[model samples]
Target chain A: MALRREEILESARVLFNRWGTAHVSANRIASDAGVSPGNLYYWFPNKAAIIRALFAEWSAASTGVALAGLADSGDPGDALREFVHAAERQPAATARYAFFPRELFALLHADPELAAAYRRNFEAGVDAITTIAQAGIDAGLLIDPAPRANLRDVVVTAWIASECAPAFLEVIAEEPASGRGSGLAGAILRSLLTDEGAKALDERKGARGHEHRGIRAG
Target chain B: MALRREEILESARVLFNRWGTAHVSANRIASDAGVSPGNLYYWFPNKAAIIRALFAEWSAASTGVALAGLADSGDPGDALREFVHAAERQPAATARYAFFPRELFALLHADPELAAAYRRNFEAGVDAITTIAQAGIDAGLLIDPAPRANLRDVVVTAWIASECAPAFLEVIAEEPASGRGSGLAGAILRSLLTDEGAKALDERKGARGHEHRGIRAG
Candidate 1:
């Protein structure tokens, strides 16, 4: 007779993305999910908990999907290429995925617990990208002297920006590259990878990718 | 007596810093400023209008201040120092001043009048930055095959990123620099401004700054 935890989260995601975390109340979420507030609370202790759960779910899914794309491939750079192609289909979901700051503003200011959790989640993301970059370097894939801190920042930052740009460009229009994150990611990939790495990536789909060519020649 | 419009905007600035755009409503704004919704309505048509008014007010003040700091100096690049310093203090205002995407989303999508206004407003902002970049080139302070389009797009994109970063970072604390629109503004300034421009910019106090210098170096 009661809605499942999954149902509640699915409904909450819809509402949270549309209305915002601040405007959506527990009652509204439960109502949208076709459940009572008590049931929603049973699964998520509070709105903050719901948000945390949502972040954990999306983070695991996004990172897992991206990483999985890279796992089986022989060429780490190509794996990353495959990963980029996979991330493009879920534009709205990706856009929603990146819309945390509006909600985070109040939570981080008020709740130490939320802030710490947020810090850990993002650091993990950066580390994930760092690991991928390290692998590329070890395999003789990437260039520009693999600087750990900077490259990690670049990839993780790119992941977040790529997710946000769709909705953002839905309004501003000029910001989105035709390849979405792929082009930017490729540019970043080229920036950090070696000549062999670049060749491998360009030949990922067995074509000479032009992102590498677009870099200004000075 | 009704609350004065300037007083309302200034108070809204404080509220925005603390509560953000979503959590705080016209009702709270009216009450905080010791007026009624009706009184506030006389000054601002809606919550978004209040936000828009604040944007205009803050942009007018900050832009004028930054411009004056530049104009008084013979060297345009030197003036850009004031611009950078101006940026650090101004993030709080920038974050508060723009309507958060969630709030801006519907109006941007549906309201034709607001959409046109949005376009004009955005174009104006881009034009201002382009003009600054052009002036440096004209003075032989900047090196550019084409100053106007290049500088404007870079500035517009980066400023939007900076404007949007706090919200994005609030959600994704792991990547604070994700939406930093102006992150590349200085680099564009440096790359386009040849030796003469760099010399001029160097003369200004606090002219040179970089959060991730490596992002632009490659």
Candidate 2:
């Protein structure tokens, strides 16, 4: 029964990613999972329930991945570089839930429960980002990117850019296949770093390039 | 007949902006407009048609207002300030079609025709922004914010920031009354400006402050 439930969720994710949540029906998800409609209904009372479950799963998974291994880094530039590296390493992490960002507002509007959960997660993410920026400022490795707005504003702006840039880039602008990297987000956040911090980030990038070649040769 | 058509369109805009496009039905739109169902159908064959009509109207209106009066400004700083001012001057211009950005991907996926039209308009907007940035570079008024990325990349990042920031700010982060201005977008774009350009922008801002005070005194 547990395996069947997992199958249903997996099918729903694939279908939602391909055809969007609105276009894909509950029955379609069940059939795609090769499960009977009754079985699917037994697991999830309705489509919204399935969506809520998926969001919960994604949210839980992302919280660990978003700022992993960067908390203890004393150097602001190292923290920023790892932040971008973590993002680049996990394109599939976000891409798996591609439909979410694309229809974020619509999904939130449809399910108030999901909206509440998402709001909590989003606020937490913002706070996490703000803390990182504040640390950088205290260390004098980061400067205020926007002189008028506060640090929270800069964090929110960077948060929004990182969150929405992928969808806009792939869907609207139709940029050529460089969609996997979090370069734009990195660029925005790095703008806040002072010259010394920027040098650290650039040097890290050079090291990463060498590591990639070494791996390829090995 | 024309007046009735306009009424239906206006009602759809209001309801879609409030309740979202997915929740609002054609009958509800007709009822809101005080028009018969048949009359609404006579004007728009389906909900998609109404959405398309609204999008067309918005695209036309935004094109005119987007870069208004900034094209002729010889100073890059002046152009940048005017660009932000144009955005600040017309909150309603984008807010009127608030649902469009929120549900952009869903709407596009549901209707191929609308998606094609939107893509065309979006590409045009990017091109227009790129031209402005290029001019700034030519005049040495702006430097590339992202040294690794090209000018178009910078513009695209700024465009995405401007396009998606409002929705994310209001819906996700729940910021206060400051959602009206395009400050995040202005900040991202202004990052590209050189010291000379930045000075011009700051001076203009100071001047605008004096003007606001004068107007209040009057």
Candidate 3:
């Protein structure tokens, strides 16, 4: 029963990501999952329940592994890379939830419960970035070049740049979401880096050069 | 008859922008416009027709007026401001079409004809930005700091930054769309400016200081 539930969710995610939630129906999800409508309903009472379950998995994946261990590293470059890496790792991780980012407002409008949950997650994401920026400032690894560069504004800029990247990639750049917005987000964040921060980033990049050798697009 | 048509379109735009197209119906539009469902059907036939008319009006407005005179400005800062001004002018102009940007993909997925039209407009916008950036580079007003800063990529960045600003403003920042995304978009573009470009921008800002004095958030 647990395995069947997972299969239903997996099918729904693929269909929703491909055709969007509006176009997909429960029967489609059930058939794609190789289950009868009754079996699918047994697992998820309705489409909304399936969506909520998917969103839960997405929220957990987003918060779990990406920003996990970098906070203790105390190096702003690593922290920044870790932030960019979250985007770089999208294909392997968050890309499964691609439909969420694109359909964010629509989904929120449809589900108040999801909207409240997402707002809390959004605030937490902002706070996490703020913490990282403050640490960077303390370590002399990040500096504000603009006279009125509020850290909050900077964080917001970073947030928009990163969060909106996948949609940007797909729509504007006509690219796949594999690299996500890593290059753009990293460039925007790098603008905030001090000379020392830049040097540290260069050294780190050199060390990881072999790993990211051909992925210059990122 | 033409006046009534405009009223119906105007009413539909407001309702769609406020609540999204999915939630707004033809009957509601006719009621809002103080017309009968029969009259609305006479004017638009269906909700899809209403959306197409709005999209047409939006495309014309977007391609007109704002980028109209700036290409010949010769000053990159002026050119850039004109680009940014397009967003600044949103509350008075394009903000009526706010629903389109936020619901872009969803709308496109629902209507292939609109998708094709949008892709064409998207290309034109990108080309316009590329031309401006190239001119700036030639005139020593813009510089590519990164080794691999392709003009197309920079244009793409600016395009994403500006085009996605309204959604970013409304969704993430929880702000109204009056200023659109001038600040963040301008900052990203400014990161690509040469020293000459920066000085020119400051002088222009000083000259127009009173005009934009309190609206610095843009």
Best by lDDT: 2
Estimate the lDDT of model 3. 0.67
Candidates' TM-scores? 0.61, 0.83, 0.77
Query: Where does candidate 3 chain A have its weakest 10-residue lDDT segment?
Result: A209-218
Could you tell me how far off, in angstroms, the CA of residue B151 lies in candidate 2 after the best superposition? 3.2
Q: Between which residue pairs do clashes occur in model 3?
A: B183-B218
lDDT (tens digit, per residue) of candidate 3 on B10-127: 9999999888898999999999999999999998878989999999988876665336426546555567655655544544565679898788767776787777787777677767
In the range B1-218, model 2's lDDT, one tens digit per residue, is 79999999999999999988878999999999999999999999999999999999988766544465356466555555556566565446778899887887678767889988988877777676666767666767666544544555555666666667667666654762234365565666555556766666667676785644422100
Clashes, model 2:
0
Task: Write candidate 3's Cα lDDT for A103-208 as tens digits.
Answer: 8767876787777776677667767776776777777876643443346555555556555566646653365212334455455556556677667666656656
* Interface quality of candidate 2 as DockQ: 0.37
lDDT of each: 0.55, 0.70, 0.67
Candidate 1 per-residue lDDT, tens place, A97-136, comes to 5445334444555667767775675566556566666677
Model 1 stretches astray by more than 4 angstroms: A1-3, A15-50, A65-115, A131-160, A171-198, A207-218, B1-3, B21-42, B59-119, B123-160, B168-218
Q: After aligning candidate 3 to the native by TM-score, how far in Å is the CA of A120 from where it should be?
A: 2.5
RMSD of 1: 8.1
Fill in the DockQ of model 1: 0.13
List the TM-score for candidate 3's chain B.
0.81
Write one digit per residue (lDDT tens) for candidate 1, span B33-148: 87778889998898778777665565565465345445535545544545555655655555555444324444454455555666666666556555666666677865543311
DockQ-based ranking? 2, 3, 1
lDDT of 2: 0.70
